[model samples]
Target: MKNILLACSAGMSTSLLVSKMKEAAEEKGMEVNIWAVSQDKAPSEMEKADVLLIGPQMRFMKAKFSKTAEEVGIPLDVIDPVAYGRVDGEAVLNKALELMGE
Candidate 1:
C-alpha cells in the first residue's frame, strides 16, 4: 500500500481532503494509507510516507522539508492551488501517484 502524507499548518485543513482522496482511491481500487500532520510533525512522519504533498498555504515549508524528503528518499511537492482550493481529492491523489511514478 502506498503511504501518502499531507502536511499543512495545523493538520486540520486537510482532513476533508483526506476523506475525499480515500473515496477516490476506493473508486480506483487503490490501497493507500493517507494522513495529514502539522508542519511540526511532518519531519518524523516523512520517514513513513511514500510521497509528501504539502498544502498550498504551507508551500513555503517545501524548501525547509526538501532536504529531509531527499534523505527519506521520497518525492515532495506542493499541492496545486486550484485543486486544493476546490478540495479536489482525485487530482491530489493523482498528483501523489505521479510523484511515486505510478
Candidate 2:
C-alpha cells in the first residue's frame, strides 16, 4: 500500500482532503494510506509516508520538505490549490504519483 502524508497549517483543511483521497483510492481499488498533519508533525510522520504532499499555503516549506524527503528517499510535492480546494482526489493522487515518478 502506498502511504501519502499531507501537511497544512493546522491539518484541519487537509484532513478533509484525506477523506476525499481515501474515497478515490477505494473507488479505484488502490491500496493507499492517506492522512494529514500539521507541518510541525511532519518529521515524525515521515516514518510511514511514501510521499509528502504539502498544501499551497505552506509552499514556503517546499525546500525544507524536499531536503528531508530526499534524505529519506520519499518523494514530495505541493498540492495544486484549486485541486485541493475542490477535493479532487484523482488529481491529487495523480500528482502524488507524478512526483514519485511512477
Candidate 3:
C-alpha cells in the first residue's frame, strides 16, 4: 500500500482531512495508508512515506524538510491553501500524486 504523510502544526487539523483522503483513495480503488503527524515528528515519521504534504501554514519549513525528504527519497510539497481550508481531500490527494510523479 502507498503511504501518504500529511504534516501540520499539531497534527490535529489534518486528522480531519486524513479521513476524507482515505475515503477518496478507497473510491479510486487504491490500497493506501494515509495519516497525519505534527511537524515536530514528521522527519522521523516519514521514512516510509511515498509522498509527504505539509500544511500551508508550515510552508516555511519546506526547505528544512526538503533536506530530510531528499535523504529519505520522499517527494514533498505544500498543501494548497484553498484546498486545505476547504478540506478537499481529493484535491490534496491529487496534489500528492502529482508530487510523486504518479
Candidate 4:
C-alpha cells in the first residue's frame, strides 16, 4: 500500500481531505494509507510517506517541504486548488500517483 501525507496550516482542513481521499481509495479498491498533519509535523512524518501533498493555503511552504522530501526520496506536490476546494479526492489521488510516477 502506498502511504500519502497531507499537510496544511492547522491540519483541520486537510483532515477532511484525508477522509475524502480515504473514501476515494476505498471506492477504487486501492489499498493506501493516508494521513493529514500540520505543517510543523510534516518533516517528522516524511519518512513514512510515499508522497507528500500540501494544501493551497500553505503553498508557500512548498520549497521547504520539497527539501525534506528530497532528503527522504519521496515525491511531493501541492494539491490543485480547485480539487482541494471541492474536496475532489480522486483528482488529488491521481495527482499523487502522477507525482510518484506510478
TM-scores, all candidates, are 0.99, 0.94, 0.97, 0.96
The regions of model 3 sitting more than 4 angstroms off are none
lDDT score at residue 53, model 2, on the 0-100 scale = 95
Clashing pairs in 4: none
What are the runs in model 4 whose C-alpha is more than 4 Å off? Answer: none
Candidate 1 residue-wise lDDT, 1-102, digit = tens: 999999999999999999999999999999999999999999999999999999999999999999999999999999999999899999999999999999
Q: Compared with the true structure, what per-residue lDDT tens digits does model 2 show for residues 1-102?
A: 889999998989888788888888899888988999999998789778889999999999999887788888898888999999898988898888777777
In angstroms, what RMSD does candidate 1 have relative to the true structure? 0.4
For model 3, how does the per-residue alpha-carbon lDDT over 43-62 read when each residue is reduced to its tens digit? 99889799999999999999
TM-score of 3: 0.97
- What do the candidate models score in CA lDDT, each in turn? 0.98, 0.88, 0.93, 0.92
The 10 consecutive residues of candidate 3 with the worst lDDT sum are 93-102
What are the clash counts of all predictions, listed in order?
A: 0, 0, 0, 0
Q: Give the range of the ten consecutive residues with the poorest summed lDDT in model 4.
A: 10-19
Ranking by TM-score: 1, 3, 4, 2
